[model samples]
Target: MAVRSHSTRVQSFSLSGYHGKPTRGTVTIREFNREQRMRRALEGLGKWWGVALLSVFIPVAHFVLVPSFLLYGMWQLCQRLGTAELATDAHGACPDCGTEQTFELAPRWRAPQPVTCKQCHRGLRLTVPS
Candidate 1:
């Protein structure tokens, strides 16, 4: 009987659709809208006189609710146009330096190749199991 040793090496890995983990900075449309609504409500309460005056013509509730909904709609449009802050995942740390270097992943990228390390400024490559 003869024994043979074989090794396989994968040079590149697909980073396509790499929706890596979402970080705290990532914002969803719903979250954004919620925050905006809260801010508007707080402002209306702070300037109680203005709100009371506005309530004469239109309900104070409508004054705050209408604009917030309009802004939310605008934000949704911008999100569809890829211009708004969305829940986008980011890449992990550098393999070489192990430093906290945050980077946005491209739509498509090949991994496990020599990429310049942001922290060390040296060629670094990360291998993934095939």
Candidate 2:
């Protein structure tokens, strides 16, 4: 595996609830190059394969564990290879409750994803401003 380097940027995003004005927020976006993506995919594969190898000593459990890990590693490899950008962190105020706080975002940074407010516990939608 090659040494991996990722470029990151902070971008402004929008948060909107069912009934309220949208709120502005910032998100940390990590962009992966081809080499970085390959490195990440290989790392995932190696990690899962390592687990699968260890599971071989678990007697009868190896039958299930090994196959599951092998398949999961392939799936992760595809996912990592396809993913070019990831959302690492997000911060914004709840549109409904007007409380400001950090938000837990999904790893894949696609717009119009569903998010929950920490203070109000209400469902909100996150989007990139056009």
Candidate 3:
């Protein structure tokens, strides 16, 4: 057998075929316009800045709002407790003090207990039945 430097094939296929046929050509190379891409990106920086600002602002807004709401909730809780402790039929208030309007707000008494409101000296209504 003799070895030949130039190769030759009998059959040929077009570009779309999956055959291993060979073609002769010098390849062309092209470069990307990177500077143009950079210019385009820089032109859109303002829009990107707005997105960045929103990302930061959203959390900051919630941070401010949540603390304010929490403070308001705590204030309301304090006010409710203060009213429960201080509001009285003692200095001539609360119609149910002497007369039994029904003690719907007081604590439960398991045994015979002497529970009285010091301000009014009137017994509080029992919340739970004995």
Candidate 4:
């Protein structure tokens, strides 16, 4: 097995509410090289395949479980292989409520994404700094 390496950096982002000004924030971005991506894809495949193998022990459920896991593994492998960067963590304050909190971000980093404030339950837009 080849050694897989990845890099991470802190990125600036902004959150805007319908009625409030945009709030500046920071996010942790993880970047994967080709080797890392391949490793991740293979790891995902192996994990799901392991589950599928274990499911074979279950007599009745194996019929559904084995096939489901096998298919899911392939899907995950393709998805991971294509992903180059991911947002792991985000921190910012809600413009509407002025409450500072960590935010949940999607695995694939894309700008102008939609996020909701946990404190105020207000919909906000996350974007990269222009």
Which candidate achieves the best lDDT against the true structure? 4
Once fitted onto the true fold, the runs of candidate 1 whose alpha carbons sit more than 4 angstroms away are 1-90, 104-107
Q: Tell me how many clashing residue pairs each candidate has.
A: 0, 0, 2, 0
* Candidates, ranked, TM-score: 4, 2, 1, 3
- Quick one: RMSD of model 3? 40.6
Candidates in order, TM-scores: namely 0.26, 0.89, 0.20, 0.90
Position 9, candidate 3: lDDT: 23
The superposed Cα distance between candidate 3 and the true structure at residue 76, in angstroms, equals 0.8
Instruction: List candidate 2 stretches off by more than 4 Å.
Output: 1-4
In candidate 2, what are the lDDT values of residues 62-122, reduced to their tens digit?
9999999999999989999988999977999999999999999877888989999988899
Question: Could you tell me which 10 consecutive residues in candidate 2 have the lowest summed lDDT?
Answer: 1-10
Candidate 1 residue 14 Cα shift, in angstroms, is 12
Summarize candidate 1's per-residue lDDT along 7-115 as a digit string, tens digits. 2222322221123432121111122234444454455444554444555566557777656555555554443343222223334455445555544433222334344
Task: Tell me model 1's lDDT, rounded to 2 decimals.
Answer: 0.40
Model 1 / residue 17 / CA error / Å: 24
lDDT of 3 at 60: 56
Worst 10 residues of 3 by lDDT: 9-18
The predicted structure with the larger lDDT, 1 or 3, is 1
Ordered from best to worst lDDT, the candidate numbers read 4, 2, 1, 3
